[model samples]
Target: MTTIVVGVLGALGLVSFFHLGLFDLSSLLRAASNLRQFILETFPPQFEILPALMHAIWETIQISFAGTLLGLFLSLPLAFLAARNLFGRWVAGAVRLIVGGIRTVPSILFGVIFVIAFGLGPTAGTWGVALYTVGYLAKLYYEAFEAVDVEVIEAVKSTGCNRLQLFRFVIVPETANTMISQLLFMFEYNIRASTMMGFVGAGGIGYYMVGYVQMLQYQHLLTTLILTFLVVMTIDYLSLRIRSVITVAKN
Candidate 1:
């Protein structure tokens, strides 16, 4: 009876999908045609724009690294306050509210506003990315703090360790690995977001891509794409290596 019911539900889902035109043949054909055109147009990336591309790529990396580091520094105290085990309930609630409010605003909107306020430069992009990253990293770090072993905390308390000492000796060590991992993840995301901020004149590889595409320079756009890919991949690889080393050390 259960198997029959499951099969019926699966069949109904398939029927609904088809009814919604999820598998429309014409849509597939159109997508294929557009993809073919894009492929034909964007080939053999322009090597001539290497100097400009290199500059933009460097700016993108700087934006990402600076923003991520700023966020990490700002988030440390906020994460401690937000952690249930670290702060009183009221303090934790207040910290959570602030973090939540910051996160509710989209990062792109932050970038746009910063561009206007700071007058369109990498500084604006740095702050925008940093603000977004703080919300995310603070939340992750708080959760890590919360997940620390209660017994270890109690042991430290029994030794007459004050709140600050307990935090230093027990909580920080317990969550250090997780915090590093979260920072790396946030850095990876910041690299991607920095590119988008360039659209608002925040000075990154994305700005160059927009300029090139608008000028109908498809070859340059392709080269920018390749360069961005290589840079992001290298950072991701390094982050993974560091994370693995940390994990092994902890074990």
Candidate 2:
């Protein structure tokens, strides 16, 4: 009875909040006609630009892969230093503060800053993506590190293992699978993000996407969207397969 009461209250609260926010169905109903017109303009995708778009797609993939790898490399040490069980609260707290600060800023803002510094190119996009990855991955890595089994650490210490040996033989081995899974997840996320890189003048397929929209070339935009969708779907599929293999191996 208590659970049911709480659920009903929560539902009521959500509805009340939406009402307070001025939620209305009229706008949606009105937009249906606009949506129909927009669809008519977007059909029959322009395939003539396929070659150029393919190159842009490849570049997007490259930027995502490079950024994710760079972030992973940087995150490993940061997370190691931030692990409370390994480094104590003071060290972990300081590192967490830094990671939190990084995470506070959005990746697009980083793209803007890097675009200014690097002057509009995939270089800026890659760095922006890397920094974004570092912010999330470092936090994740340290949490995983701290979750290491206490008994295992103690057993390793009993063998006269040094800090490095303990980490290598116990902590790392335990967390290896998790690290790989996280890396793959981040890579998938970065791909989606890299598509927006062009909005900030950082190069990617998004540059063409922006161009198409500005030029009111919805047909071209539709082509880009389709290609992007296919690419993202393929990456998602591959990541799923990789994660599945890792899960099976771990089991």
Candidate with best lDDT: 2
lDDT of 1 at 32: 92
Per-residue lDDT of candidate 1, residues 84-172 (tens digit): 88789999999999999988988778789899899888999999898988889889988999999999998889998787887789888
**Best-fitting candidate, scored by TM-score:** 2
What are the lDDT figures for the candidates, one per model?
0.89, 0.91
Q: Provide TM-scores for the models.
A: 0.86, 0.88
Residue 64, candidate 1: C-alpha displacement in angstroms = 0.8
Error of 1 at 180 (Å): 1.5
Instruction: For model 2, name the residue pairs that clash.
Output: none
lDDT of 2 by residue, 1-251 (tens): 99999999999998997877546567667678888988899999988989989989999999999999999988988898899878889988999999999999899998999998999999999999999999999999999999999998888799987877777888899999999998999999999889988788898999999999899899999999999999999999999899989988989
After superposition, which runs of candidate 1 have C-alpha atoms over 4 Å from their true positions? 1-32
